[model samples]
Target: MRQVVISKAGSPDMLRVVDVPLPEPDPGSVRIKSAAIGVNFADLVGRLGLYPDSPKIPYVPGYEVAGTIDAVGSGVDASRLGEPVIALTRFNGYSEALCIPADQAIPRPAKMPVEQAGGFLVSYLTAYASLVVMAGIKPHDRVLIHAAAGGVGLAAVDLCRVYGATIYGTASPAKHDFLRARGVQFPIDYRHQDFEKEVARLSDGRGVQIALDPIGGRSWTKSYRALSPTGRLVINGVTSLTPRARRSLRALLRMALTTPWLRFTPVRLANDNKGVVGVNLGHLWDETALLREWVTQLLAWYDTGRIDIHVDRTFPLAEAAAAHRYLHERRNTGKVVLIP
Candidate 1:
């Protein structure tokens, strides 16, 4: 089998191709013949050693892949063999083949295109879990999504439209037409304008009922401000993870004093209905049933054409470093897929 190994953490150039013996399926696992792999900003963070649980050097780093079931382990059904499937592996996705737990692999819709199936499930499930499961989005709700042209952003826009919500998205101006075409009513150019003011203006001062923010930093405060009195805010990323800002001594002291209390602020029983939730898809697999359920819904959406994900670009596996570089530059408007 061939895989991209991260022998060291730094630039995309550090990712190297290597050959290794094929891995056998462990009990309850399924071996997949790789078709297409999804490249994400989170994977880049993992490769750069910025992720909190960064793996040891010489690790395979990929989160999701779509492929065919080539074999099944002891506890898995042999009937699953040769089935098209997708799985969220957290890591080790950049390879010619892989064996993962059977439950982690969901059968791809027979009618869904292979490339779409491979790149679809992860981002849609993440968006669905955050918007539908955590936030309990309702029709007519005013919503705001940051990075609206990215994979998860487009999913959020599409899903919000399905639920009859009025959607507002923040993206580069060049990407606004794409967002608008996808049903986003207000597409704000975050580069040249303040999204906070734009959201308020677009909503006529009622404020958005929900705000999905994966871009963290000073943006956190603004995300909070964009919400209505009972609005929910979900934090799913910290691209702001890099060195950028430092707090004043007084601010640091206040943060230290409030940290413990702030951590529990999102409790559903709290008197304040306004909410803040954090989502990490990797951690959700602890409840395999939930992951399977979400994957099922995503596949159904793709089958029905309720969600249209524009795959802006794709690269063959050999050019993964170039793919990573493109994602880092933030130039693409949709999913960046690696065809193996």
Candidate 2:
């Protein structure tokens, strides 16, 4: 077997593919012959050493995979062999074959492609947790989604469309048409225009009911201000911290010095009639029952054609570094997967 490891935190070049002994499943676990591995922005953050929760260096960085079960350990059902499934691997998902607890592997929809299944769980789960679970989204609500063309952003757009919410998404000008096609009614060019002003103008100065912000730093302040009274703001990621492929202490210090951290106190919330919350899928691993519930609902939506998973690019496992660079450059409009 082969696995991609982050030898040391630096640039994409730090991702090295090396041969490793094939892993055998322990009791109550199963081995998956990975067909496709999901590439997420968090993986990039892990490689840059910006993610505090990331494991020590010289580790594999992958969260999800879709593949076929070829082996099972003791106490596992032999019938599960040859089953096509999607598994959530907190780490070590970059290998050609890996072992995971059998319960973590969910059966893939019969009609869904393996590539789509590979990228499904994390993005949709994050979006579902933020939009439906946290915000309690309702019909006809005006919503603002930053990075609207990215994986989680697109998943949020699809869910908002299902709930009949009008969407205002921010993206580069090149992805504006793509965002519009994905149900974003107003696509603000974040590079060229002020999204806060655009949201106010587009909503006729009323502002949106919900704002999903993943690009943390000062963007959180703007997203909060773009919200209407009683509106909710969900901060999910801090991509702004790693503006480049390599770690730069100087850049990190500058961001900390320039960005104002808003205090959301009880009085502030009561006076403004607004709410702020955060969602980190990585931290929710222990809430197995909750995750299973959300995954079940999401899979049903996929089966019924209520939502769609868009995969923008697929890279060979050996080109893991290149894959990271692609995501770092913000060139992919949807999920990026790696073939093992």
Candidate 3:
């Protein structure tokens, strides 16, 4: 088997491919012949040695893959042989093959494209946990989403549409038309305009009922200010903490200075009748039942054509370095997949 190994935590050049002996499934596990792998910004953070949940050096760093069952272990059903599936992997998804617990693998809609399935779980599951589990989004509720054209941003846009929410999404001016056609009733160009001001203007100052912000920093306070009374805010990531290209003293100082901006007290939250929740799927590996349920719901949505995901590009496994650069530069409008 072949897999990309993180030679060290630094540049994309540090990621290189190497041959390793094929792995066998442990009891109750299934081996998947990798077809496609999903690349995420979280991968970039891990590669930069910034993610606390990251494994040690010389490790594989992917979270999701989709393929077919090549073998089964004891306690697994023989009928699952050759089954087409998509699964959540701990950190070994950037590989030719992998063994995961049988229950972690879910049936991919036969009609769904393999690349889409490979890139689905991380973004959509996080969105599911945010909207359904945390916010309890309801019909006609005004929702605000930042980075609205990115992978998880697009997923939340579609899911909010299905639930009949009026969406106000923040993105670059270039993405407004693209997002407006999807579900975003209002698209705030973060580079040129103030999202807080625009959102308040659009809502007549009543504010949105639900806000989803994965871009953390000073933006956290802004997103919180855009919330209505009793509204819910879900903070899922902190891309602003690290520079995309390389480490810098200025970037590190900025991160430190912005730290106090995201702080809030439980007393303040309760007094205002507002809610703040954080979701990190990578850190919730032990919450198996919840993960399975979320995956099941997302697959069902895909089967019904209610799940819409755009594949920005696909790179052959050998070109992973180039792919990493693309994501690090934030050039993609949606999912970037790697074909093995």
Candidate 4:
């Protein structure tokens, strides 16, 4: 098998394609032949050595894949062999072959294409969990989504629309039309406008009921302000600015001194009832079955045309570096992929 490995963390250039022995399925594991791999921001963080839970250097960096079950290990049901599935792997997905626990592999929707299925599980699951489960999204709710043209952002839009929430989205001006066409009523150009003010204006002083913010740090305060009373702020990723290697001693001191002060801002939150929460899908391995259940729901929705996976681009397996660069640069307006 051939896989892309970041021999040392630095930039996309560190990704190296190398041949290795195909892994065998251990007990309670399933071997799969990957057809498409989802490229994500987590992969970029891994390359930069900034992801909190990533392994050491010289490791594969992908987290999700869509493929076929080639073999099943002991204690696994024999019927699972030869089944089409999509998997949520912590890493090691940038390859033609994979071995994962059976529970980590979600059965693909009947007749769903490999590419869409490959990219569907992670982002859509996050969107579903954040918008519905975490946010308690309700009918006629007002919502704001940052990075609204990206993978999880778009998925949030689709699922929120299904929940009948009115959406205001932030994206580059070039993606405004795309977002509008996808049910975003107010599309703000984050580069040229203050999204918080826009959300306030669009909601007519009421503010959004729920805000989905994947970009973390101080910029996230704006999303919190965009919410309404009892509105939940669901944050999933820290893509804002960039993930730093290590904080300087002075920077650390400043954070230690000022971190708690931000909460006291008089103008913060929505009507004194808003809340902030985070969703880290990679850290949800303890609830892997729950993720599979969400994947099944997303695939079912896709089958019924209630949602869609916008595959902005697909690169060959050897071009995983380019894929990472494109995602990190925010050039793709939708999910990116690697065809192995």
**Higher-TM-score candidate of 2 and 4:** 2
In order, the Cα lDDT scores of the candidates are 0.82, 0.92, 0.87, 0.83
Candidate 4 error regions (>4 Å): 241-271
Number of the top candidate by lDDT? 2
Candidate 1: lDDT over CA atoms?
Answer: 0.82
Error of 1 at 294 (Å): 1.6
Q: Candidates sorted by TM-score, descending order?
A: 2, 3, 4, 1
**Residue pairs whose backbone atoms clash in candidate 4:** none
Q: Give the TM-score of each candidate.
A: 0.91, 0.98, 0.96, 0.92
- Once model 3 is optimally superposed onto the true structure by TM-score, how far is the C-alpha of residue 152 displaced, in angstroms? 0.4
Q: Which parts of model 2 have CA positions greater than 4 angstroms off? A: none
Candidate 4: tens digits of C-alpha lDDT, residues 249-314? 453354345333467354664448778877888888769767767766776778889897888999
Q: After superposition, how far is residue 117 of candidate 3 from its true place, in Å?
A: 0.6
**Worst ten-residue run, lDDT, model 4?**
240-249
Worst 10 contiguous positions by lDDT, candidate 3: 241-250
Compared with the true structure, the alpha-carbon lDDT of candidate 3 equals 0.87
